[model samples]
Target: MTDIAPASPRHQKNMYMRQNKVLKDKVESLELEVLHYKEQIDKLTLGDVPQIVKNWMNEYSLPWEIFWCFEHEKWIAELDNLFPYHMENCRCDKCES
Candidate 1:
């Protein structure tokens, strides 16, 4: 094995810049992916089967009873997260209507 010399200051700065650019690019790509997912989630309406949930059910191929129980639990958790802290005081027109 050969010993390597440390990078010079200019070389180190160049390496750092390349790394920063790569990281920034990766973050931008991930942000776009999250936005895509959010758009897909937003398209869901009442009684609609979300693609992910449908895939999960098809992949597992669970009995209807088991699937519904798990589905209900998942909905409960989602509902808990979706509600505002002051549910009764929500100002949205949809909530009022």
Candidate 2:
């Protein structure tokens, strides 16, 4: 016969509490990181940018145009063919003359 010593109820509760605390800490840390990333994205889209830069981007083209530019090289190449002159003239806010 095997002698098995089960954990006491108090010990099991303590272990569960400790595991819960660790999980909570990790979740809080991940939430903080997500908040920081959201702040960075907000800065990119709406804050931190100068008015002149915003004006330049507004003049350049649609949001999808820029999104597609970075999203896929193949799309850019196709766009380059369809709008060769416009593509040549297109510039991001930072690259605007």
Candidate 3:
């Protein structure tokens, strides 16, 4: 007859600590990924951006947001040869040249 022993309190606490640390590490990794993506998005130009995205940009109220959408169609080929040249422009108040 073999007897199984339950985990000790210290062993349980160590397991719990290990799990918590893994979750925290995952969260930190995700945060770093988000920061990297934000940096890339910051470098993106309005030119060649899709009309669907441009529409949202025009609708946005923030000036910088609108500027980021400025020079719309500058990357014309990005339209995949589907969208018209005049699909959308920065119509925001701050869009004036």
Q: Could you give the C-alpha RMSD of every candidate to the true structure, in order shown?
A: 15.7, 9.7, 10.0
C-alpha displacement of 18 in model 3, angstroms? 1.0
Q: What ordering of candidates by lDDT runs from best to worst?
A: 3, 2, 1
Query: lDDT of all predictions, in order shown?
Result: 0.50, 0.55, 0.55
Count clashes in each candidate, considering only residues at least 3 apart in sequence or on different chains. Answer: 0, 0, 3
Instruction: For candidate 3, give the lDDT.
Output: 0.55
Which candidate number maximizes TM-score?
1
Model 3, span 1-97: residue lDDT tens: 9998999999999999999999999999999999976765666642355665566456643333433433441222222222233436424334444
Tens-place lDDT per residue, model 1, 55-82, is 5457656422222223122221121232
Worst 10 residues of 1 by lDDT: 71-80
Displacement of residue 79 (Cα, Å) in model 1 is 29
Better of 2 and 3 by TM-score: 2
Clashing pairs in 2: none
